[model samples]
Target: MKAMLEGLEYAPEDNAAATTAATAETVGYAFSSDHLRALERDGYVVVDDLISQDVARAAAASARAMYDRGVMQNLRQEGRDDDVAVLATSSLPAGDEFAGLRPCVEALLRVPDDLRRVVARVDDDALGADVVSKVRACRAPDRLMLARYGSESCRYVPHLDNDPSDDANDAGSPGLRPSDRVFTLIAYLNPDWDATRGGRFRAYRPGVAADAASPSDFVDIDPILGRVVVFDAAKLLHEVRPSFHDRYAVTVWTRGAELLPA
Candidate 1:
């Protein structure tokens, strides 16, 4: 696991805990202890001023341009015609408009040791030695998608990024077998987002049934510029509130140990 995070195929026998001891810098936002603590306790955290507003605006324009040009398709759900995205894990061309979004993207791709430790300590007992090792071993994310939910009363129904039942078994022995997402990082691109716009990312607290979740069990965050939301991909039940205006964002899906560090 340690070797995997270090961009290696293998390593000599040693404590996996020792692998992530090396430090990684955060370019988009300072990952303070408070931020990490919030994630450990709440299963999610929202970051403000995540990236420069200028960059976020540029990204939004580029994403919308691409979507308008037909590079993106409608989100694969029934009746959500306006909601669209580039869902593939394809590489962004060098010097493309999306380049400025890289800092926040890379900051998340390079998983921090502190974050690994926090996730390892989650009360879910299924995060046994094996699953915890993958959490510690994972150092990179595998998918980055640019998305837009257009105004037309568009809303995404509740869904989990990864199935909780598959978490313990998501990482197979020795190399990338089949992979499931472990975390989701969404960086909003709209700078002048109005609170009255109505598109908020609402995620329920851990353990609440999505179908039966009460208003008191969730937190709703505005999709504003430089705002980034990250959370446990499998455990948190989340949905997109009805959007009154076009909503654009860059989304990163962390595939634990599925992608060896590059």
Candidate 2:
């Protein structure tokens, strides 16, 4: 197998030093040294207010429109009200219904260059430390937006983003090898969410279960808009609890680069 990243720009002698130094000087929402250390140790970290209210509202509006249109066939078939939950895998909806959300997705992805830079820095650090780097040459996915309507029936069961089975070699999903994910970034777009509203993201730590572990090892962050939670995608097992009210957010996952056929 050939290395997934061959012509990429990460080099320790020259580029890594410059990247590390440049990251240290920037001023914005960032993970503290202590927090970074914690993440390195426990596999996750959370930064509050990563997105602004204007951006959150725009994304929310777009999500709501998409939900109303019944883009997610799974949710509509259950006869659940539109507000219950919405999940957008790639980009924003394109029709007139989701026109407003296009800008919202673009703005959300582009607004925090500094934050994006920090994440890149962290990705580089993970690479250097021999941590599994899942997605190479990718900053973050455009958006994995979700909007939950006022219903408790739309709960996401606990699960890991990556396949955990060791028998992947024998599985039919060719070219897709089993991998241990290193990081996940989740940003909440709902400003009014709280513990009482439910739908709080619950995580269980490693070793908590013989079969399934949770992501709440070191921290349990509430679903607050502008809050970005970065955690070990493998060790941090998590689930979205049901919500009595509406809930909205954008989620992104990062993993170590996968082995590719030569």
Candidate 3:
């Protein structure tokens, strides 16, 4: 497990204790069971109110400030006042800009621990325990913070996180095997998003009518504030729809190391 903590600068000893405490105290037994079932059947589940409103608002503000500053820097570089220049492009902020929002990031990373405890409480290994055990065996967890601004159009095309062609037997390949990508966590920050204002998270299950190798077989997920969506990253094809209003969120992938077998 020491290797699992490598390269993560924020993996402090106290943080580990806090994570364990949080997992025990805050994890929802009923919701975890239902969410695990949803992932197994439809490939995705929306966990409502995972974060409190105050925390979500702070995260949204941080993302907006960081994005706005980045866009301004790009504008200065281009020497243009045209709103079109800013509207047509997107930029990445320095990692430090998001450090304040680390709590949200940690919540996503610890899903395995939460699920494990939940399974213990329920005395079920059918789905939830199986998912957590597979995640633990693999041991490769990755995290990323993504921010999108008004009119910037950071819209992602429909796609699968893992290559559909790859399987467990073909281990040393370029892309992920089915077991590697156990979860895809997206924490939404926008509170007022409606049908008219887009940027919903969309997912598609296998064998669906419109199912291409791509994420075109879409199911729309509203970008509700304090909401977290977790899904089977390999099997669930999903995408971020274009936003009429500004939108931002942290997207993370939790993978297992056994799939890599390095």
Candidate 4:
């Protein structure tokens, strides 16, 4: 609950009330108006030590157990050759894998909805007046997921979560929204993760030209335990770098209800 945010940007003095607005009941993650603006401007934010080490370890065990229990399904059939297994939270069952970790998972899932409401009030884009209409409207997000990545130097190539940034998405299924996703939230569960083992998460700034982007244009986030990352899904290109050791993540994708005003 004590969020020592590692990649937080701009806790500006103008909107100082941001800190007070994000009460525990409104947002358990301690997201401020600054965090919301960071998402809009820089495209990402990283929070470290968001949970206790013990809780992170327990979540890691549960994620691994789910994979061992055949609850996690492979992504090979979807066409990519990466070694990844994922399961939706709605379909996730109650068992030893989720005994005490369920509440945390549920809380993590609710962050998007809660955060949107907070932003809609404190932030200018998230702010409101009787004559003005809301620019960013929060919508129902897709189901939360628990993902386990294999340890055999498996890498998921760089790409945006919601490519094309529209409703006409390719993962064409009534239940899936590979295009409407507005924001992506990921929590690392590996309490003892080794940084040298790789699998660092990377996020790219919006490409200004067709081929002008380079390595320096992106930011890399180490997948350490108790670390949570929130980013703009459609705006920033991201990827899971190769991992020599395994990785566990709880991910939630928030849906985009309206186009952000320019």
True-vs-predicted CA distance for residue 7, candidate 1, Å: 21
> By TM-score, how accurate is candidate 4?
0.74
Model 1 misses residue 183 by how many Å? 1.1
- lDDT string, candidate 4, 1-262, tens digits: 1121121232222222343245454545556666666666677878664555676778888777766766666666332334344434444445554554554455455555556555556745452331112114433343567776778876676777777844456566543567756677788887667778888887877673324567688777888987889877766777788887878888877655452222
List ranges where model 1 is wrong by over 4 Å.
Answer: 1-29, 78-90, 94-99, 111-135, 164-179, 258-262
Clashes of 4: 1
- Off-target runs (Cα >4 Å) in candidate 4 are 1-29, 77-88, 123-136, 140-142, 165-168, 208-213, 256-262
Expressed as tens digits, the lDDT of each residue in 1-262 for candidate 2 is 0121122222222332344455445534454444555555655566675556676666677666656656543445332333433223242344554554443444333322333344466645543342323223223332244545455545565655554654442343322222433456666767677777776676666556523433444245577766767666666656667776766666554323232222
lDDT of 3 at 31: 54
Best by TM-score: 4
Candidate 4 Cα deviation (angstroms), residue 233: 1.4
Better of 1 and 3 by TM-score: 1
Q: If the candidates were sorted by their TM-score against the true structure, best first, what order would they fall in?
A: 4, 1, 3, 2
Itemize residue pairs with steric clashes in candidate 4.
120-126
Question: Residue 176 of candidate 3: its Cα lDDT?
Answer: 38
lDDT of 1 at 235: 64
26-139 per-residue lDDT for model 1 (tens digits)? 342245546655665677888775566776777777676666656667746553444444332324433454355445454445444445656645654533454355456554
Give the per-residue lDDT digits (tens) of candidate 3, residues 1-262: 2231224355422353466675656654325567767776787888875766777776777666656555322223121111211110012223554344556666665665666555555645666555656544433253354556354454565656665564443354332333356677778888777888877777766666433444455678888787888877766766666667877776666666454434
How big is the positional error of residue 232 in model 4, measured in Å on the Cα after superposition?
A: 1.3
Window of ten residues with lowest summed lDDT in model 2: 1-10
